[model samples]
Target: MRLFFKKRSTFKLFLKLTDWNNLLNSLTQNVIGIINSTKDSFTGDGVFENKERLGFLLKTAEEKEIKILDVGGVSTKPGFKEVRYEQELKRFNFFISNYFGKFKLSVDTMNYEIARHALENNFEIVNDVSGFNDLKMIQLIVEKAPKIILVHRHPNSSDIQEKMNYKDVVKEVRDHLEEKIENLISHGVDKSRISIDPGLGFGKSMEDSQKLFDNLEYFSFGFPLVVGYSKKKFAQNLEMTHEELYDHCIKSGVSLVRLHIAS
Candidate 1:
């Protein structure tokens, strides 16, 4: 709630248009492939069966040359049943023990227990749609020292809340991220280990998400920027393929792009 940057402004960093692997600590932007382990995702990729799905995750990452793989144990979309901590960790542990050291890993979960477990198994990033709202999550992240992605959400009508309200969408999102970043730093988390996601299609409407995508540079927050524009309903609304939207984002200075499948 406390705005960190009084005089807000966008941060600029140049990356080779064709060579985006160097954008995030020299990691390629080929893709941050999404491998959902849940049973019911709105996008239709969730797999409850572990052995087969883990194989899919590994094979997809390997074949596509995707450097970062984001494994979501629980369904994060609205109207889905909640996944118990036990179930969530089970999927994550199996994946972490097998493929952790082989590649960079991010777990899309908001539960502190699951996050702590993933970090123990050498997971490097936490992509929390709740914007890391839990104090316990913040504590674990501070102690474990993995990258944290705080996604913007406006508390909403569904089980997933995106309660965002603002006249200037970009400025509001930027202010919110900066405020959260300052709070994390004050609580002993390293500034360099923080990143922000605009939470496309989460709390924001299609228009708000588009504004955030267009103004990606404004919310860099001096940390890595992750653009998640793949398979979203908003892309469908605009009558543009996810790949088409993805290219537009990269041109606007997206360093890391999270996708349902690697392009």
Candidate 2:
């Protein structure tokens, strides 16, 4: 299918698209389908590097009616090789330039420059897993005013995988999110435009991650919650099946889940 940009106001479309109450309350869970552009994704589901697979997965996503597609060029997994800004931009452009479909787009990147390019190119959401710690990234959000997914990682660590001890994982994560949200609002970003992710596997042990997931309700401070639970190491250790976990997430008022197509 060809890229189709609807002849409508983007801001209005965004508001219409993100009907928060409907999404949170709906029995049908909404998902932000994860599509990696690099070859080293933790789940081995990268697509943009392989044209054939990319096409197939895009088709699958369309057929599956995935409304929000989170496209990432860099792998946040531990030991993932660092991709230069140019290479990551090229990978993102390859996908953005080629596909325009019914689904809204979310660019998953920690780099401010990459997020700027995606926003310039009409990507709707900025899924910054670095928790918007970068001042430049925050300034970009202030200027562009795009929907964002602010993730939580340990403050002491530089990357997503370096686990740090938490006196209380749930409370710590909630406080981190609360602070981030306040920062965004102080910078003039509408709180309604922001969503949150607890960053499972980003910096916590499996026990900590599980504890946060179990107490997801604690983080429900009016803003919608976005979760990326697919293939998380913590989920493997849960007593319940993935299906049960997912159902629980939806029931817990999770607004969006970053999931693979198979899920």
- Summing lDDT over every window of 10 consecutive residues in candidate 2, give the lowest-scoring window: 4-13
lDDT of 1 by residue, 135-237 (tens): 9999998888887777875434243444456699898777877887888889998776776787887766788877777788686545657878776766667
What ranges in model 2 sit over 4 Å off?
1-29
Per-residue CA lDDT of candidate 2, range 1-263, in tens? Answer: 23111211111112333534444343233677788888788888787658877778778777766677899999988777778999999899888877757767889998999999999887878999888889999999889878889999777787777888999889989988888788888988766678889998888888998998898778666777788778888887788765677666766766676788753
lDDT of each: 0.69, 0.77
Clashing pairs in 1: 21-27, 21-28, 154-162, 154-163, 154-164, 155-162, 155-163, 156-161, 156-162
| Model 1 lDDT at residue 167 | 94
Which sections of candidate 1 miss by over 4 Å? 1-23, 97-101, 154-160
> Which residue pairs does candidate 2 place in steric collision?
3-100, 160-202
Q: Count the backbone clashes (under 3 Å) in each candidate.
A: 9, 2
| Model 1 TM-score (2 dp) | 0.83
Cα lDDT of model 2 overall? 0.77
